[model samples]
Target: MKLQNATVLVTGANRGIGLALVRALLGAGVQKVYATARDRNSLEAVTALDSARVIPLQVDVTNHDLVSRLSEQAPDVNLLINNAGVLSFGNILEVPVEKIHEQFDVNFYGALNMARAFVPAIEKNGGGAIVNILTLVALASMPGLATYNASKAAAWSMTQSLRASVSDKNIAVYGVFPGAVDTDMLAGVDMAKTSPADIAKAVLHGIETDLEDIFPDPMSTQLYAAWRQDHKAVEKQFAGM
Candidate 1:
């Protein structure tokens, strides 16, 4: 679906790539952007963009009841961007099990809840798009961030299933993978990172063209190419990173 004049709702809109997506959507001629975060106070920057178009909403995607309420609250929503994520760095053997659940709660289950809650609304509005901000790590495991990688991989698989389920509903599902984005999620990582703004722009472009899987950064594109050629080779390469 075209983003122009579309009503879009973005989760985790307080900072990082989510904030950048709100900005990019505005430039794309979107009619409204419901910028949601767990803490609405953190949405000051987003609300400052365009008071009329930027609607700050306080929402925790992990809350199933609250997410279900979105179908009634924002009935006009057509595009849903699942961008909220968490990263607790530790190897699978060393990381606290609760930490793994925490990451999955937001990264995987949260996205699933949002998708379920908004599907009816999106269908009502004549089917639009769902963009899941997954990671390149979804395709491979990084030893230090084993839990995060696992959570994102689950989300990646979920996105694929959602796409298949929604095939006849006219709703387009997009899975975005970017390697090492310059966001708080990668605070301590010392590697070449893509700007959130650039990733956001690329995502919008992908949506415009109805690209099913979007590789929004150079690293992601290269890694995807390698994976396509030899998945195991790329997996081994990332395991060492």
Candidate 2:
């Protein structure tokens, strides 16, 4: 859907890519943006943008009751951006099981909860869009981020299933596979990283163009191209990274 005048709800809007998306949405002239975070106080920056247009809500996507409440509270929401996620660096075999579970809770189940709770609201509003913030690792695993990769891969599969389920309802489901972004999530990563602002803008552009899967950054764009040509080769390459 067009960004202008659309009422949107963005989960995990306190910082990083979520914050950048809030900034981009406001700049894009969206009518109202409900910026949600696990803590309301953390949304100070977003609320400061425009008190009237940027409404802050305390929402932990993993909490089913809270997400249900939010769906009721924000009935006008036409776009749901499921951007909340966690990253834990570790090899799959040695990573703490809790860390793996934590990643899945926020990255996979959390997005699923948000979609389940918000789909009805969006449908009532004559259908809109659901943007699931995924990662390039969903396509291939990186050794150090194996747990995180697994979580995102599950999310990626869910995104596809959700799209098929909602296609008849006119609600567009988009999976955004971005490469390493320059956020706290990748604070010490030595690889080149794209700025959150650039990624956010590219996501908006992808949404406007009705792309089903968005490769928002240069790295992701290149990786996706290579994967399409020969996914196994790309997998082998990432395996050696």
Candidate 3:
């Protein structure tokens, strides 16, 4: 979709990929961007990028009421980017049940909450797109990040369902699967990571090009190519990581 003059709402825009996305949207000449975080004050840096264009709002995506209210407040939004996420390091069997729930709340349900609340508003504005920020591991199980993988995999499935459900409504759903991003979320991981700025730019390009599934970095593109050839092999490869 054309981003120029598009009104967008980005969740978790206070830092990392979310913050980078806000910058990219502005650079793409979007009319307005509602940059949201759990605490509105946390968005100072993001809003500072363009005080006139960036409107900071507080939202806990897990809270259905807050998301519903936010949708009402941002009635002009045509694009919604579900970028809020949380990660925990643990194997499925060894991970605390609460930890799994915590990750799912932010990574899976949070995205769903925003989608449900915003789809109608987007439709009202004559249809647009919903971009769900997922991960490469969602396609293959990684032992160390079992819960994070499961939650995002569920979201991947949801993205497809959402796409089918909204196809005729002029709404598009894009799933972004990026490999290790150099964000605070992966600060401790020792791997070659793509900068968030690059990922943000790529994601905007994917949307403009109408790529339903986006691999925003070299690593993700390479892994996705391998997975399509032999997914089981990819699973085994990730199991050892």
Candidate 4:
């Protein structure tokens, strides 16, 4: 889990939290980073961060074949970051079923795809870590973001299962739960938000300190504390949001 000279691969690295993570990794002195997006051209800025260390790749995480091929390309990847995600706004009953499916595909299945492809390689390389960028809402459903909440919650469960499965393999699985961030993903939301850079730094710090579950932002940290005290109360609060 040491960041120094670690070769890492991060999905959806073109912008937002992923891009911030890439920059943070560079600052931490990582040897190389495979930054992936659906479009290679969209990654120009990310690659420009450190042209030599940042290797841009085009990949749709939903595509099994494409995700599977990444392991072959980045055989030296010891750290994998499952950061690609999608969001849809709607109540569960009224949301378009297709939109629900799309969110699940990216938020849940995409992380699974990347983990499946990389875990073996990481094991071969003598242990490493898999970081899943989940959300605070995963622990409590927000009515407005119904589908997004469900999908991320499922991923949170998967992250735990993955951790237990790989416990003896020397692979560490870290789940990051962040509250609202100032990113394009929440462009119009009028709420106090943490910067993606701060979230990225916190995530790397969690890994270095061996924190299995990371609440990266202030809001998430406070909310998680409340949830631990009374999860049902927190659930009701989110339900009304």
Instruction: In angstroms, give how far residue 64 of model 1 lies from its true place.
Output: 1.3
In model 1, what is the error at residue 189, expressed in angstroms?
1.6
Query: Which tens-of-lDDT digit does each residue in 61-118 have in candidate 1?
Result: 8998778776577889999999999999988899998999999999999999999998
What is candidate 4's lDDT per residue for 212-232, written digit by digit as tens?
A: 999999999999999999999
Candidate 3: list runs displaced more than 4 Å: none
All candidates: CA RMSD in angstroms? Answer: 0.8, 0.7, 0.5, 0.6
In model 1, the Cα lDDT at residue 107 comes to: 96
Candidate 4 segments exceeding 4 Å error: none
Ranking by TM-score: 3, 4, 2, 1
Model 3 Cα lDDT, one tens digit per residue, 124-147 = 999999999999999998999999
Tens-place lDDT digits, model 2, residues 1-241:
8999999999999999999999999999999999999999999989998999999998999899999999988999999999999998988799999998899999999999999998988999999999999999999988889999999999999999999999998899999999999999999889899999999999999999999999999899999999999999999999898
- Model 1, position 233, has a per-residue lDDT of 97
Lowest summed-lDDT stretch of 10 residues in model 3? Answer: 86-95
Show the colliding residue pairs in model 2: none
Winner of 1 and 3 under lDDT: 3
Which 10-residue window of candidate 2 scores lowest in summed lDDT? 88-97
